[model samples]
Target: MRYDVNLSILFTELPMLERPAAAARAGFDAVEMWWPFDGPTPADAELDRLAGAVTEAGVQLVGLNFDGGHMPSGDRGLLSSPATSRRFRDNIDVAVGFAERLGCRTLNALYGNRTDDTDPELALENLALAAKAAGGVGATVVVEALNSFENTRYPITSSAQAFQLLDQVPGTAFLADFYHLGRMGEDLSALIANHADRFGHVQIADVPGRGQPGTGELDYAAILRQLADSPYDGHVGLEYKPVGPSEESFSWLEAMP
Candidate 1:
């Protein structure tokens, strides 16, 4: 069971450009992230700099999310919104190109918050479109399920819901985030046992407060052991918020069995 630190959440005290090296120095050899720019389209110079940072750090860029609206302001995603479909389409090439440059194979497509004005069919159509574009570059699209408590407007709140959308997009797979499912009171063990083959990637954070593994009630060692025994071979992304300094928060890594 290998692990990758999510730079978007951990080591966030540093500038975005410096986080990859910071994570590498902290003994992480791989990293993942949400859209690193303020918008779907960023200047080529900015893109090159970020790609250079990851390369200079010598870490594998594993997973990345397509533009998920304003993450800091809690916009879950843009794909599900009719208004943002154009932006989502525009971002496909940019996101795929960046991933290809970094040798990243898994691209997460967050299902945006549901709106009365947005037709579900349109959202599905856009997701399939994104999948087709990413597939052309030999990358897989991943659909994630968010917790209802924090993401009330985001409709895909369960493994069942995520799979439904995944079915619509042929090459897409489900991103099983234990933290979100556990926070929603879903059976993590059962989910892993039943759908491990369908998971393209996995992310972890402890429940209750979304902190490091030990800071909450999740039995990660047991969960990881299950993953190891199962068919899921993807890296487990450490997506938790540190309770203290990010470096100090890594004691749980050494403690993982």
Candidate 2:
């Protein structure tokens, strides 16, 4: 099982490329990001620079969040916003270019929930269109469902609902976060096994606090064993906030199968 570090938490203390190197130094094989495409609009040259960092650090940019909704002050990212529809498409085109440069093949398109009168069908249509746009660059798009308790605006919650959305879209898939799935009242192992076919990327965090593994109530070892037994082959993105120092929180990496 390869591990990835999301640079959202530690980018300030280390260089972008050094984030992966830090994880590698701690015995991880890969790294990821929430959204590394946020700089003066989006461009391939910038992404190529990021790719260069990853190559220089000898770590893979396994996954990235193409949507930019998590910014403060509650602005929904693309795939769900009408005002930024064209802008979002343009951003995704730029992201694809960056993905190619980094050799990253999987992208998490977290569509922010709309609180307006926009019909659900319209949202699905926009999401499908965005997925098609991502597929054009040979990158598989995985629509992730965030827990409403933590992110009250995130729309898709249940695994079944995420799968249903994927069913609606032709070339899209579902990303299952154990922390979110458990928060939304789904059995982790059962959900993982049942949707094994549709699972693209998996993230883990302990319950109640979203901390590192072994700090909370998540049975990560069991989950990893089950994933190892399944046909699913993907990298597990670390999307939790570190309770203390970043490296200290990940000592449990030695415990994952």
TM-score of 1: 0.98
- On residues 126-238, what C-alpha lDDT tens digit does candidate 2 reach at each position? 67766777778787888777777867866778887788788888888888888888777788888767777787888888887888887778789998899878777888888
Alpha-carbon RMSD of each model:
0.8, 2.1
Candidate 1 colliding pairs, count: 0
Lowest lDDT block of 10, candidate 1: 248-257
- Looking at model 1, the pairs that clash are none
Q: Where does model 2 exceed 4 Å of error?
A: 10-12, 15-17, 43-45
Quality of model 1 by C-alpha lDDT? 0.91
- Give the winner by TM-score: 1
Deviation from truth (RMSD, Å), model 2 = 2.1
Error of 1 at 215 (Å): 0.6
